[model samples]
Target: MSSSSAEVLLVRTGAAATLDRTSVGGRGTVASALVKTPRLGAVSVGELGFQGDVQADLEVHGGPAKAVLVYSDEHYDDWVAELGRDLRGTGLGENLRIRGLTERDVCPGDRIAVGSALFRVSAPRRPCYKLALAHGIRDLSARVQRSGRTGFYLAVDRPGEVRAGDRIAIIEHAPHRISAFEVNRVINLDKRDVDGARRVLTAAADLPPRWVAKLRRRVDGAVESDASDTARLYGTD
Candidate 1:
């Protein structure tokens, strides 16, 4: 299949900074790089991520497999409509916002070339409360998952420079044909989807190992894992 004519709308990077907030639902100080600034020109891409980009929580956020986070600019309209507010400069903490492709259009393990960098689609982002905190929406993280607008992560295969307006083209497609949407659906929305879980496992070699283990256990009929600490992770009362 031909690659979609995806164009990067923005390239953003940020360092970890302190955000102090007090609200009816919550109050605290947190270190986050969720607030990103647009990079005006080409930026270096490395095995970890774009130059100057940093994740506050390395435990859950950044790693070799999640070097870059890509969001679909296409979802912004839906979000604006749902939130009933102006989000003109809000990035929702994404590294690259691009058009012409969404979760359904990309599959795990697919190799994509954007600018001079080569990347492999990794997995759907499992959003948490920092996203909600960033947007001041208590349920925004949950909304992102349930809406199937969960942007994806990219593992840099060949480190190079990237910048705004770079063309995104898939150089190789995953053999399994399972889109990132289906993977997120199986894991977050359709936990009972045994068949879907099996299909996801077919692409295990190309997916994040943590997700692979989760699916493997599901396929083996193992007991469901411990529930996520939603209150802690989502900052909801």
Candidate 2:
């Protein structure tokens, strides 16, 4: 597939596993292994998530709104340069390592098809403490958010099979043009931009409820800073 034509560069799935307590902010012995195993061929995609994939914490991760986490192959080089290491095969806790589409190109509510499975872009993936735990980097989550290189989540619209080489085509573009990159920036970095927050919360009808709640808090002056609730929910702290 052409670079402009979105494609699944890799298909990955994780087993139910635990985290070690030694990692910073580790949720000792939890039942999730966000790190995924790259599948060699086709794999089934479901509404909850990919086959064999399990999320440790449901309060923050793994739901209909975030059934499939997607990361761009485009960001791998940047991550290597920044972290001074290779991150391939890490899955980045994402079900699909994709090419062609980045946060800037996709928006909430956009519909896409990968092989036979269909998905709707639900929201941007909020980097939490789990990210730091997964990579053994103390400040990776903050760095990812600041760089606006965070990936996105996809809500499964139609269950089917997806392979590594499957073409990911945009079947429907969202009417609202608020990209996932903008959403991440507004929520994680620019909490003071009341106008921007209002635009995202009001214009993006399909924005995830948790994000909507957070943005509403920001718009209403309920939150005084950029401290997010994700750490509390996932026990990243």
Best by lDDT: 1
Candidate 2 lDDT, tens digit per residue, 173-227? 8887888999988877787898999989764588867678878887888765433
Q: What's the residue-level lDDT of 15 in candidate 2?
A: 80
- For every candidate in turn, the CA RMSD to the true structure comes to 2.0, 2.6
Q: Which stretches of candidate 2 lie over 4 Å from their true place?
A: 1-4, 25-30, 224-237
Residue-wise C-alpha lDDT for candidate 1, range 1-237, written one tens digit per residue = 235678888999999986554432677777789889899999999999999999998987899888999998879888889988655476778899888888998999999999999999998888777777776777878888889898999999999999898999998999998999998899887887889899888988988777889888888887464357465446533
* TM-score against truth, every candidate: 0.93, 0.89
TM-score of 1: 0.93
Score residue 195 of candidate 2 by CA lDDT: 90
